[model samples]
Target: MTCFAERAPAVVACAMALLLTACGSDGPAVVEPPQETTCNGVATSVRMLAPFESVVLSGSSAACFALAGGDREYLVIPQLTGELLPYGGYGFRLGDPSPAVVARAADTTSASIPSLSAEQIFGDQVHSLDAQARLDALMRRREQREATGVHHGAEQPTLSVIGVPPEPDTMRTFSVLNTLGETPGYSPVTAKLRYAGARVLVYMDTLATSALSTSEISAMGAVYDASLVPAVMTAFGDGSDIDANGRVIFLLTPTVNALVTASACATSGFVRGFFYSHDLSSTAATSNRG
Candidate 1:
């Protein structure tokens, strides 16, 4: 990542100028603006001062903020409405019970098993144990198991842990290829759809198998809906763009893209943009314009 220290001077200057302009009057003493306004046509006002640009996200009534003065430019989407939709990455599912492995009783009549502690296994230096001491402790545990008729060479129980299954080899391969900057068997796909009356942006790694993995998407839906969606809706309700620059830029992530894919927005068409990068910072820093 590019260090902020390398870009601080320009950012500081732009921020200072923005702050000064926000203070209303140009004198050294800051003048306070009116607390309330009686503008009837539009209840809210969206302002874009120097060194900043406002943009309306395509197909949505959301406003995005972008810094215009610095070389390292990034877009900031305002808060979204409501809680984010739950996201589970390409991993095990929650609340699933682990498989239990049980051993057959060697002698059902003898129901007693010896209980051993750390002191018995490691002597007085349990806290300061060496590798040899650890090995000896493990050997003692093995002996206890052997005494209970649990043979070391016995075939263990085959247990399957209950959870989400592993991703397919195709998906795994695609993930690897994506990291290597190769678009082997899939092309980038994007779509725009309306969910609960709010516009949604969807980007997909459209593959041949049509199998989807949560690992390749973005998880910022709730934040975008809460912050950017309402603002866009308001601005568009009044028939205005959030930013005069016309387009809003968003740093896409795997989790966020996953949310769109899981939602009703994954249908063909409504394509807007291409897949850029999984790293948001790199995407933002390199995006010169929306």
Candidate 2:
């Protein structure tokens, strides 16, 4: 698909030296209302790096919006500290019940970290739809959009990206995945919004996002069970770059975006996957050229 025009970021972004970038806004437009920051009965916030063992998501600023109604909640993750680069889901804490644990975005300014996973936070089973197969179908739709000459289609939902440059070489990649998919237990396909910036990226999807590296999964599959990723997280929790192989991931979106699923390291080495999702955030507007 033809990539849209570039939008200039807010003029008031700060600087983040690491992860090769810094500061990006959560976009200025609010298409929805605001919601209270709570998962299950516990409160959730962007600042709390609780039970999460990997790099905590932080940044210059984050925006929060409310979901209409149902049995589910939604979050919009914008530019983060390179944490949103992967194609998976990651929260600040390990929710109970393991696979089906839950997550949500707290108030933009809240400070308490909530538990994660569908079972841990919501105490309900996450709809068990085979993530890989669904993604395959979605990818096929995107391919159709590319062929039928649809600049804006159901597959590539429009999204806005504003590049706030604090320096000459420094840059932050902004993304917004408006509508991903849904499951049986929760809501009906909410918009999985994401924004990856200097130090923060937040996403709200109803399932365990399956955009992860399959080759890596298969190779590491043999080792992933006893891999003890949390243990590694604990070791490098307090110190950045402390872990020699920090965490790496792949983006499996076949929609002609930026990077692809080739990032998996030999499908054998360490590629610390943090958060991942399928994105089609329809951001409209471009201030750079027009």
Candidate 3:
């Protein structure tokens, strides 16, 4: 089989070239690369991966976009703050059928989170306030909501802990098999990486029999870690840090693997990923990262 390095020469070269350019700068003072930003109420710029082009949709969040290319089409939505629930299907809640339950139902493996406290996840990041104060504020808000008979959904809640970041390193790959049992037009075995960046949810029209191998999934993750992550962080004005705020969802169609089984779909032949920002007015550009 051809390795990812052989197949994606340009990806490797571009990444190295960018690094070299930064290091080779002659100035004694560090020269920061140009940053992208957006004004309030303005449309945010989206960075489309590869062949994916942006499409307009009404009544959608500023980050919502309909991407299409070749035979692949899907929607990308970036949530500002919400629970990063595991995927079971449309309407699937996180604890209703927990990650383990979902994996068992699908007859596939599930990702596991290491036993790390919020402080461990965000090492050295100072807390915005004391834990007691935050908890008091939370209790007050809950009391007000309860008295008013107003209840927020499971996914909608203000983040009480401000310093804890999502540890992407601990996020493992899991498969969602028998997806047809829950929702149609979904991949039979969907690979998911659960992290704590708001709750970026990616929806794609996957073939019933299509699935990515473990190696392919690793390759994709490497690509994300190397190229896409930096671009996304820069676009959001978060510098080069991976543990930044906001969310990004990627909609992909596996086309390179000849091992893929035949399946029916409305479209075919393209793979795409999307980046989003918390502020819709944040201007940024999309590059072909995957």
Candidate 4:
């Protein structure tokens, strides 16, 4: 399964910008969907890994797809309340046991996954050994700040690893197509859901072998829940717009630079302001526009 979120070079994460308003805690309220075609965007997905696959995924785009498993086939998803990411992708039910763990596994499994636009994003110069080592040091500093009760306008990187549920030998993984995650002190976020199953997670930036505050974990969990819980579970039963409800729709707006700048957002079939999208392999760059 493939899911994605937008990524920018700016590591300076802003604090929970607007006050952290209590999210859709009543849990995800179900909404009767409009006709599938009326709402859902064209279903699609980023490149995917083979079956029984796991890895860390980060991007500025949205991912779309689902999985099916078991003879009786049942999908198991972690309790993350977020909108089900949508896009054209392979289908399935049974998958790695947990998405959170899967997301985290991806982070650690590989030493590094190269970026699409290197000089553009990573060019900020992590200023350390490798990305992993630099990431490790960053996490340590975050802990010190929190311990000192330091408050700043910019929040640290959003870091938190999740365990994907283990599956059989075979599994599917997606190549980058969309973006994922919250603020700094964190890596990135991911969420994928379907009628049979859904997986969602908040990848906070921190050392894997450490414990997180109960409240911090709860808050991240709430973000996932706020976005997925009710959004996918009680979704309307219409397969026609199935694709639209599953993919992240692109609504591009030009930047002041005169060069085209793209902003990506998820448009689950259930959400408003979602539209159809065709593959337009594009990149956003901070460039000098004449």
Q: What is the C-alpha lDDT of each candidate?
A: 0.26, 0.27, 0.26, 0.24
Which model scores highest in TM-score? 3
Residue-level error in angstroms, candidate 1, position 126: 71
Cα lDDT for residue 186, candidate 3:
19
Model 1 agreement with the true structure over 66-156: per-residue lDDT tens digits: 1212122222221111112121111111110111111000111111222234564545432222222333444444345545764567643
Model 4 spans with C-alpha error above 4 angstroms = 1-199, 207-214, 236-290
Which pairs of residues collide in candidate 3? 38-283, 47-286, 50-288, 71-267, 71-268
| Of 1 and 2, the candidate ranking higher by TM-score | 1
**Candidate 2, 1-290: lDDT as tens digits:** 00111121111111211111112224454233223343334443322121221232333222221122221212222321231123343233212211122232223322232223333222222112123323333444544454566454354432324333133223223232222243211112322323222322222232334554434434443342233333333333422221122222222232312112445322212222213222222223211110
lDDT of 3 at 87: 18
Query: Ranking under TM-score, best-scoring first?
Result: 3, 1, 2, 4
| Evaluation by TM-score, superior candidate among 1 and 4 | 1
Query: In terms of TM-score, how similar is model 1 to the real structure?
Result: 0.19
lDDT string, candidate 3, 99-196, tens digits: 11110001011122112234522333212222222222333343444446534442222322324444533322212211111111212334334323
- 196 in model 2: Cα distance from truth in Å? 6.6
Please list the residue runs of candidate 1 whose C-alpha ends up more than 4 Å from where it truly belongs after superposition: 1-198, 207-218, 236-290
Q: How do all models score by TM-score?
A: 0.19, 0.18, 0.23, 0.16
Model 4, 215-248: lDDT tens digits are 6555655644554444434332322221222322
Candidate with more favorable, higher lDDT: 2 or 4: 2
